[model samples]
Target: MSKVVLITGASSGIGKSIAVFLVQKGYKVYGTSRSPKNIENYPFELIALNVLEIATIEKAIDFIIAKEGKLDVLVNNAGMGITGPVEDTPTVEMKAVFNTNFFGAIDVMKMVLPQMRKQKSGFIINVTSIAAYMGLPYRGLYSASKGALELVTEATSMEVKKFGIQVVAIAPGDFATNIAAGRYHTPVFENSAYKENYQLNLDVMDAHVDSGMHPDEMAKAVYSIINVTKPKIHYKVGDFMQKFSIVLKRVLPDRVYEKLLMNHYKM
Candidate 1:
């Protein structure tokens, strides 16, 4: 039987790309959107879901189980981005991003893990970002949320490794997607001194995303991770320089790395 796969936030961006690519490659793919009326007519099945809502998450999982009989893979690709100076970002706004990006992903993993444990085999890949590892100006909240997911993936993998369930985090750099449209810019940042720099940073990020790597590359990475007998705990997918930057951060002095990051973003 073809492997059964479920991906959240599959309405657009990288999530949508993964769903389409997987289905073409013959995986039984189910993609999700929060609203029933807002989904595109995709080749794979669609499930309505709101990652922040536990009930909806459970329902989506149950629906998959009932239809597929078993779940083999889950890609927690559902997430939102918030951009602004952290100082001006409201507590509520920060929480809102975490609710969707981190907590919501955790809920899906918690819901799916039980069945994965029972079957003694499954793969859970959380779609994180390169920003999770680096400190990006104006995108601090987005970075922190994904960073939280990365740690969870690492810790959870250690716990579930004995059960034959693999948990992995795939951190992608900027990709050509519609993520910018959905990103929340902190409203409170308007009066801050950092406003000018914040706008410049936002503009830079937008340009990078507009001309970034294709989502198809991410789909291929996901496909490979699923097929592996022993998948890695983390996979960094993107430009060589972005991937190399992670290494540079590790080997370079803290002082030097900080300067490089500032220079890279023109901060």
Candidate 2:
């Protein structure tokens, strides 16, 4: 029997690339997006899903189960980016970011795990970001959200190990995706206390993202993890910058690392 995999946020970017690659490699891939209208004639199934919507998530999962009869993998890839200072970002926007990035992913995992436990086998890959490790100038919310995801993946991996289900997280750094373009830039402050500094930080992040690696690299890493016999709990894939950032986070003092990151963004 062919293995089945469900990927969210598949309309474009890394999720779409993974879906195409996995389908070509002969997995029964189910690619999901908030709307399926724009994506057509794909090698595998395309389902409509908004991770924040419980009905949509349930419907998409039911569709997959009815069609495939077994769920072998779940890729919690649907997420959005919110960039701004922690204190300056609106509470609503922060909640929205967590809704899609952290809680949304958790919802999918919660729904899928029961089925995987029944089958006694499955893999869940949470697509995280290197921002989980390093906090950038205007990306406090984004970084915090991903940091939460990393912790979730780690804890869940251990929890599910006894159930024959594997959970893993992929933290890719600076992928060339629409996230950088589509990012919601919240006001750094309502009082305009740091407008000039905030704008400079945004510009710095914009340039860094513009020069990031292509999304296909991340897709390839996803494929590799899915095929592995014993997948890692966390995989960090990206350029030298990403590795350096993670290393710094591990070895440097919090204040020292903050200075380094601040200097990187010229803030």
Candidate 3:
């Protein structure tokens, strides 16, 4: 029998790419969206699930288990993006992004673990971001949110290993997707200290997304991870420089790396 998979935030972008690829590969895949009903003619079933809502998460999981008898893989991909200067961004907005990207991912993992534990075998892949590796200017909160998920992925992997559940994270660099359209961008305040530079970085950010690697590359990475019997705790999918940045961070001094990022963003 084919493996059953559940992927959150599958209505578009990387999640959608992964879901469609898996379906073509013979996996029974279910993708989730906040308003799945509105989406039409999707290759796989689109279920109603909003990461911010615990009740919806529970219901989606239950419905999947009831139908499939087991959920073999979970792609915890649901998330939101927030962009702004850390100081100028509202604290509430910061909390909100963390709520969806960090707490929300954790909640889905929590809900699925019991079932995964019962099965004695499962895989959980958290879709993080390359930005998670280092704090980027004007996107600090988004970085923090994904970075937290990366750490949690590490801890959860070790904790659940004995139960035959493997948890890991895949951080992707800028992927050509509609993420920029959905991201919550705090306005570049006219009177704020970061206005000019923030505006500049925002433009650069969107341009990167516009020219990003195809989402299919991320899908291929996810597919490879799923097939591994002893997958690594972390995986990264991106262009050479994007992947190399993580290495540079490890080798470079604090201020040196900070300067590199500042130069890249022209801050």
Candidate 4:
């Protein structure tokens, strides 16, 4: 029998691409989104799920369990991006992004983990970003959110290993998608000291993402992870510079790596 998979944020972008790819490869895949009606007709079933809502997440899981008899894998890919000067960013905006990016992913993991524990086997592939390890100038909230998820991913692996559960976080470098369109930007203050430089770097951020790698590459990475029994605890996909940045941070002194980041952003 084919494995059963549930992927969040499947309405579009990386999540949708992964879902479609898995379906073509014969996995029984269910993708989730706030508005499932728009993409429910796709090859994979699109379920209505507002990750911020616990009850909806429960319902989506119950729907899968009822039909599949057991949940085999979960892809916690639902998330939102926030961009702005950290000091100028509103608390409400930060909470909103955290609600979806951090809290939402945690909730779904909690819900699915029980079933995986009961069955004695399961896999969770978290869709994190290359920004998970470092904080970006105007994208601090987004960084913090993914960073939080990465911490959870690492800790959860050790916690769930006895139950035969595998938790892997894939840090994908920029993938050309609708992430910018869906992102929430904190308002820039008129007298803000960081306004001018913030705008410049923000535009650079947008252009960089606009020319990001294809989502198909990320989908394939996820596919490879799922097929393996002893996959690594962490995975990085996309540009060599971004992946190498992770390595550089480990080898270089704090000030040296920090300087490189500042130079990259022209801050």
lDDT (Cα, tens digit) per residue for candidate 2, span 138-245: 788888899999999999999999999999999988877777767888865647777888888777777877888888888889889988999888899899977788
The global Cα lDDT (0 to 1) of model 2 is 0.87
Please give each candidate's TM-score: 0.96, 0.95, 0.99, 0.97
Residue 39 error for model 1, in Å? 5.6
Candidate 1 residue 255 Cα shift, in angstroms, is 1.5
lDDT of 3 by residue, 1-50 (tens): 89999999999999999999999999999999999875567899999999
**Who is ahead in lDDT, 3 or 4?**
3
Residue-wise lDDT of candidate 1 within 1-267, one digit each (tens)?
999999999888899899999999999999989985544578888889999888999999999999888999999999998988888888899999999999999999999999999899999999999989977778888989999999999999999999998999999998999999999887545568887777788888899999999999999999999988877888999999999999998999988998998887777
Clashes of each: 0, 0, 0, 0
Error of 2 at 68 (Å): 0.8
Off by over 4 Å in 3: none
Best to worst by lDDT, what's the order? Answer: 3, 4, 1, 2
Q: Which candidate is the best by lDDT?
A: 3
Model 3 worst lDDT window (10 residues): 34-43
Clashing pairs in model 4, backbone N/Cα/C closer than 3 A: none
lDDT for position 175 in model 1: 97
Clashing pairs in 2: none
- Give the alpha-carbon lDDT of every model: 0.90, 0.87, 0.95, 0.91
